[model samples]
Target: MTSDPTVEPGPLARSSAVTVTLLAPVARFSLRARAGDLAALSGALGLDLPQKIGDRAAAGAVEALCLGPDEWHILAPEADAGRLAAAAAAVYDAAPHSLTDISDREVTVMVEGPAAAELLTIGCPRDIDRIAPGRGCRTVMDGVTVLLWRDGPERFRLDIWRSFAPHVIALLRTGCVELATCS
Candidate 1:
């Protein structure tokens, strides 16, 4: 399938209060396997799998996100998708599980600034203040499904479908403007 070039925009906005940056492309995979299979899975993937909900584990350029009891989302440099998929397939051989490449389906937008969490609270129901760094979960913003994660005390990353990226960035920019005016 061909993606619309017009929908992609660069650096939506920047401010001391909040700076929105479009992240470079990365490989993303959706994984579903039984908890019992984690050991082998981790060994095959060459990265420790996070065992707790909302937890994330990273080794080098690869990171694994535990989205559920038996589900995870893996992110890595675009060049490593094939290798990672191969490892997963080898590990899950004769086992029941699912692994899918979703790299091109979504885009990542990073929000960084002292008011980053506040800007996200405008549409997300989760209390951003409560989500500590290195953790994230699936949530919806303005009805758009997204994976919200805190990368640092003042930095947040939102993973949303490529189609919804523009709308989400616009909302974030609006929030930044509103916060600027309020302060």
Candidate 2:
């Protein structure tokens, strides 16, 4: 895949109401366990796993997000990968659970400013107006799978696969340009 010039740092794209910023590397873990084992899993990882779909919980720099009844995505500093993985292994030992490291497989982008929601709506089908803070869901933007979450009132984050990062960034840049021209 070609490197997307739109994500080359130093403010790739912006408008009076929207700006897209690429985020630093972060650790990511994909977890799956039965509801009955959630408590144990949480105890093992020392992370409070979110219970409801779209719900998100954070402990310091680590965050646990529920993607489904039995699926969760954990995000933390890349340095914590080993420690977190060890905890998960110990807790799920002999139990029917799966924890996989996906830290290097994805990239995170931050979209902020007043028009952030409108910019996302250009390609994302979810109702950005309806997503409350502390909630997120797996969705597609321009056909690329993404994890969308609101980090603040006018700020949102998109976690996209590494290979698709360029495509998504390009889309965001184009959206920003269009929004700027219209306003």
Candidate 3:
């Protein structure tokens, strides 16, 4: 299918390289830390613990969010994925936290445009607005526990497990396609 050239602003569509996939509009990352070690993990990253990271995440300074007591997910541009993975690993290497490169294990999809929010409603029951911008929540979306973040009014980022990545993507594609047809 042809992309809507006019959908995104000029700079947003610019490519840095031909091989680099700009999953633009949406991207995802998975970060695993030892259970109960998230606080220490953040310290290594120069960020505070718990919801403190979420505060900075909203401003777009850093897109880090706590997924569980021992788990956290850092969302950024697809281009930054490699750097982020290494940075996180080096920080947690000798520490109590165990870091894993889950970049290839999950499907990160970006849902943008005027219908982004509406499309998300198909899989998410939470009030997307309640989470606010830059902030995210760990909730079960369509029976899947997903970390949903509101990066912008028309932008959102979803990180699902590697095994379920394809299914999640299919579901999203179906939802968005259904919206397009309905509208």
lDDT of 3 by residue, 1-183 (tens): 124332221222111110101243334455566645665666555555455434434224345676655556665566765665566676664556555545554544456667777767888898876767767777666788776767777677665655564456556656655765666
Identify the superior model by TM-score, candidate 2 or candidate 3.
2
**TM-scores for every predicted model:** 0.93, 0.93, 0.61
Deviation in angstroms for 155 in model 1?
Answer: 0.4
Poorest lDDT segment (10 consecutive residues) of candidate 3 = 13-22
Q: List the pairs of residues colliding in candidate 3.
A: 26-110, 58-134, 105-162
Clash numbers, per candidate: 0, 0, 3
Off by over 4 Å in 2: 1-10
Off by over 4 Å in 1: 1-9
Task: Tell me the tens digit of each residue's lDDT in model 1 across 55-165.
Answer: 999999999889999999999998999999998899776555898999989888889998888899998999898999999899998889999889999999999998887
Q: Rank the candidates by lDDT, best first.
A: 2, 1, 3
* Cα lDDT computed for each candidate against the true fold: 0.87, 0.88, 0.56
- Quality of model 2 by C-alpha lDDT: 0.88
